[model samples]
Target: MDFDYDLFVIGGGSGGVRAARLTAQDGHKVALAEESRMGGTCVIRGCVPKKLMVFASEYPEAIGYARDYGWDAKVGDFDWSAFSGHMRSELDRLEGIYETNAQKAGVKIYHGRATVEDAHTVKLGNGQTRTAKHILIAAGGHPVRPDMKGGDLGMVSDDVFNLEALPRKLLIVGGGYIGCEMAGIFNGLGVETSMMIRGAQILRGFDEEARGHIADCMGRRGVTIHTGCAPVEIEKRGDRIWVKGSSGHQDEFDDILWATGRKPNTQGLIAEGVGVKLDRRGAICVDDYSRTDVPSIHAIGDVTGRVELTPVAIREGIAFHETVFRGNKTPVDHELIPTAVFTQPEMGTVGLSEEAACEQEPTLVYATAFRPMQQAFAGGEERVLFKMLVSKETDRVLGVHIVGPGAGEMIQFVGVALKMGATKADFDRTCAVHPTMAEELVTMKEPVRVLD
Candidate 1:
């Protein structure tokens, strides 16, 4: 069938943009429609901006460390106006790069919402219908507020990047990574930050010991954590937002932020007759190759609810191009992905948690927690943890989890070793980098406990 374009991408996110650009570069006519920013969540409202904020928030403590090291450094009052202005400029620059690169690759860009009219047709926001030989949906997810009264009075994670001023007292809801990270960020910025976690512990799926250590560290640093508590109601009085928790805790704050969770963008995406299957969470149900039920349509990224990470989305996009354009039949892989949570005492983990690995077979847990040399020398009480979950039967390291400085960067390297199926003996045979916290990984001689 003759079509207006060879491919129509319904999002301009990392996945859709890469797929559209690559397909267009391969001499196929491609059209990409985005309702919002070109760089999607990661580049615009998410990782980029959030990481910058994390960096910005760390300076006050860093100044204290510098003073401790005899540098006489001191932190001044944080100017929200100047910092937010710079963040805005940086985001604008990144958005321009996304659009320019796509254009350079010969992909036609549409700055409006696009919906599936059928398996091979897309209707834009202006009611203009365009038919394509294939359609790609990479529409990303959005942060959701709690479905409770006065929930609209609170802000989502997206609203954090645009705050005109930082609140003196901030109440954050949710126990996940987003909520914890923000708690650290705001607390570091000298805000009176408190977290209300409905779950028994923050970072519910992580290693239990690591979760406890992080919660303790955040608490020690002055972030109040209300665990096993959830907001039953929210009320506004004068300039204060009051929240009543299920645990009979009530507090008033200058602002309340909701970091509960995110949901996929699937509403109005697939037409009534299009027969695209969506899972219970409204995420597109696609096969290993990202192909939907209809042959001419596919979905990737957060919309598919598969490993909702930016790099994973880009990898899926490349896999899609390899399978469709290069005849390579590449299937997306989601195993052993390393992730980092940017809390004050950060966490980087790959592979299964100790609890998860023990369920399958005998496992040996090697772990250590101590005050690192840097912090110890400066009379700081900050502690770091290094843990490894090893399979007793196969002698392979099943998981590696680190909670400390540069854990994220360390996990990336450790992830490569884990991916190559490195065993405990392999780590033991390696020499430790002296005076480094990561040396603990190679030096832990015995299992703290054996789970059979």
Candidate 2:
């Protein structure tokens, strides 16, 4: 019953690469196929380069505030071409690292798209096939482009990173995290930016107050926010790209970026070839154990359309190996995962939203908001937003949401506490860290409103 390899992974994303590494370390012969770059979407076009631009944009804004904090500021110029050149260099460095890691772990990395030929075999675009005892689909997701007139005049998520120079004014289509982050980056770097989302608010799933605050803060920071609007068509005249959407809303910009949404990268892979199932949204179907209808085949990450996050992908990839290959049983709780949005001010949240908790049970909602010390020092009007939802009956902390500085850095540990089923009392009993904004979590007064 020996196979050509123990595992054959398609897609070298966080999930696929992680699976290849871990399973190989576990002494499983593994070969992974990546149609594009070694690092997949997150490393190539999405998170890595996007975040580097976020840092570059924020530094200029930070420099302006340094003088108010009694620090002398040295005049500096940021050349977009030069900065982008370095970013590309770092990306190439990461790509090499991924190759080195795969090679070190004894993974046969194939630089071609893969298709599932059967339950235990995958055929590559390069006309080679590999047989494995187990197969994992971690192709990840990509930005979805809408069909409309002149839509090609604008760019989508992938094209944004390829820009040789910054645009003067940016009109962003779709108000998801991608749109919001792009808007924030351009605005921070002194570009006139406007955001348009089909939803009523920017982030539709989070706490209503937090969503409202995000919109208000964006306005307060000079980025235009337009909600409940859908783009009808795109037009170009001279150097300006003009977008006309539903309700006759017309906006023009030097550059247009559409962050509308992402589709699971499962357009192919021969799901039906082996009787694997897919959800209505075109995502590979998987259970809590990530096993598809076909027992030997499995799926994870955005392809599964479960929780579309990088960490989730990696964790699931590793957990999958533990359950199947290593004869150990471990699972990732799909709920209450911590995540961050890297916009102008940044936002972090863990666990359920107040809206979600209240829906489960009319619960207690205790919230606090303020201006951080940095904003105070810089005389900026942006405010920090923090809130927690707790179950009135069980006293369990149901959710934690924050919009402000260090939101990502602060929510991670809280996420761990939540996964352990820590109660509100546990948070309160925990000693507060002084001279820190995070301390506010432990020091908040009693519940603002406890729903019976």
Candidate 3:
């Protein structure tokens, strides 16, 4: 059967762009359609801009540390205008790169929404339809506000980067990574920041000890965390946004942010008769190879609700190319993925949490927490943690969790060892890097607890 193109991609995100470009480079007639920015969520409104804000927020703390190091470091008020302007420019540059790279690889780029009309047919918003031998859906997810009174008044994670001015007082709702990271960013920018989450602790799915440590550190740093609380009602009162929590707590803030959850961006994407299936969460149903129920249609990235991380989506894209285009049948490996949360005191973790590891088998836990040399010498109260969960039967590391500065960077290297099935003995025999916080990973001699 003849088709308008060999492949049609429905998103321009990291995953879609990757698959389109690589497949097009292999001499396939590939075209991509994106309704929004070319770089989609991660490059435009999500990771790139958020991480830049995280970097900007850290400068004031660094200035404080410099004063203790005998350097005259006087910090001034954060200039959100200056930083946001630069951030937007960086996003523009990145978006251009995404489009340019795809074009260079001979993939046609269409700037409009593309919906599946059939397994091989895609209809653009401009009233044109294109047919392809294979269709790829990589549309990412969007931050969703909870259903509540005056929820429209609350901003979302996407709206944070575009705020004209930082609020004097900000109330953040939710306890996930998005909410905690935003709380830190706003607090460091000199806003009176408060967070409300229904969970007993923030980062509910993480290691309990690590979550408590982060909550404690955030509280000590002046971010008021209202756990066991959630907004039941929100309204505007005079110049402030008033929120009434389920815990009977009431507060007024200059702005309210809703980071409660996210949903797949799949509305109106699949035609009614296309026979594409979606899961209970509205995520596209895809198999291990990212193939949809329909033979020629596939989905990846946040839309598939698998891992929900940018790099994982890229890997899925690569695997899709290997399977479909190269006949290699590569399935995505979702195990032992290392991830970092960019809070003030960051958290890096890979593999299972201690709670999860123990449930699977008898586990040994080793953990240490102390103020590192830099913070200790600077007279700071911030502490760092190095923890490992090991399988007692197999003698292999099941998990590695670190909470401190540069924890993210350290975890990437540690993730390599864990992915290679490195045992606890492999770490113990390795020479410790002298006078380093990470050396604690190797130097822990005994398990603090043995769980059966």
Candidate 4:
């Protein structure tokens, strides 16, 4: 059947943009509808802006280290106005780039909400209906705020980037990566930051040792972390917000930020009405190739609730293009993905955690925790950890986890080795770069413990 376009993509996130651009580049007609900005969460409100804040927050520590190194360095008051203005400008430029690139690739841009009318039809908010041979949904997700009394007075991660001024006292809720990262950023920016975790520990899904080290570092850095507790009620009194914790504690703060979690963006798309299967979390259920239950429809990125990372979404989009356009029948490989949490010290990990490794089979753990030369020389008490998990029988490195500076960059290279199935002997055979923290990866010859 003849349609208005070959592809009609709902949402302009990383995955949606990539799919539209590439499919159009292949000479197929495409139209993309985005209710909001072009760059979606990662480029606009998420990774880019958040990472910039993380960099901004690290300056005070850098100044301290500079002073310790005998360089005359002092940190002045942070200028929130200047930084936020510049950040908005940067975001605008990035959004323009996304739009320009999509236009250059000959994809039609509809700047309004789009809903699925059927497997091959979409109705935009502007009272226009467009039909396509295929439809791709990449609507992404949004941060969730708890449904409680006076919760509307609190802010979410998105709201943090738009704050007019940094609060003198900030209360961050949730124990996930977002909460931990924001706590670190606010604390470093000289805000009296306190984190309320409903669970016993933060970063619940991460490696236990790495999460514990991060919690300790955050606490040492002056973040009042309250674990196994949560705010039962929030009250706003003029400029101050008061929180009553489940553990019978109460406090007032200038800001209350909820980093609780995010939910899939499938509200008005009507995927289920058009025979698309949705999981319990409202994420569209798709096969390995990102094809939805309906043959003419597909979904990717956070909307699919599979590997909710930007890079993963891009990869899935590329795979979808290959399978549909290039006749390559490619499926996204979502295994052994290396991830990093940008807390104060940072945590980078790949493959299995120690718990997962031991649960599977006999495992040998090689681990070390000590003060690194740089911090030690600076007369700082901060320490770093590097750990490796290896299978006793296969001798293959099962996992590598690091909690320290440069852990993120280090894990990127380590991820390549793990992806190539490098064994413990392979790491041992590699020569050590002397006096570097990463050298321990190659030099740790003896197992700290072997799990039977």
Q: Rank the candidates by lDDT, best first.
A: 3, 1, 4, 2
3 against 4, candidate with superior TM-score: 3
Q: Looking at candidate 3, what is the lDDT of residue 405?
A: 96
lDDT of each: 0.94, 0.86, 0.94, 0.92
**Where does candidate 3 stray beyond 4 Å?**
none
Could you tally the backbone clashes for each prediction? 0, 1, 0, 0
lDDT of 3 by residue, 1-452 (tens): 99999999999999999999999999999999999999999999999999999999888899999999999889987878998999999999999999999999999999999999999999999889999999999999999977767999989999999999999999999999999999999998899999999989999899998988999999999999998998888888999999999999998999999989999999988889899999999999999999999999999999999899999999999999999999999999999999999887999999999999989999999999999999899999889988999999998999999999999999999999999999999999999999999999999999999999
**In terms of lDDT, which candidate is stronger, 1 or 2?**
1
Residue 361, candidate 1: C-alpha displacement in angstroms? 0.8
Sort all candidates by TM-score, best to worst.
3, 1, 4, 2
Give Cα distance to truth, residue 419, candidate 1, Å.
0.8
The CA-based lDDT of model 4 is what? Answer: 0.92
lDDT per residue (tens digit) for residues 1-452 in model 2: 77999899999988889989999997889999999898888898988999999998888768878888878994486688898889999999999999899889999988889999999989989778789999999898888777777777778989878888888898888777888888888887778888888888887787788878888888888898777777787777787887786867897789888787888887876846579988788899988889999999999888998888889898899889889888888785678789999977888999888778877987888888887887787887778888989888898888998888889998998899988999889998999988788988998877777765
After superposing candidate 2 on the true structure, give the runs of residues whose Cα lies further than 4 Å from its correct spot: 74-77
Q: How well does candidate 2 score on lDDT at residue 117? A: 91
Error of 3 at 319 (Å): 0.4
Which ranges in model 4 have alpha carbons more than 4 Å from their true place? none
lDDT of 1 by residue, 1-452 (tens): 79999999999989999999999999999999999999999998899999999999999888888888999788999998899999999999999999999999999999999999998889999999999998999999999987788899999999999999999999999988999999999999989999999888999899888888999999999999998899998988899999999999999999999999999999878889898999999999999999999998989999999899998999999999999888999999899899999988999999999899999899999999999987887899988999999999988999999999899999999999999999999999999999899999999999999999
Q: What is the C-alpha RMSD of each candidate to the true structure, in Å?
A: 0.8, 1.6, 0.7, 1.0
lDDT of 1: 0.94
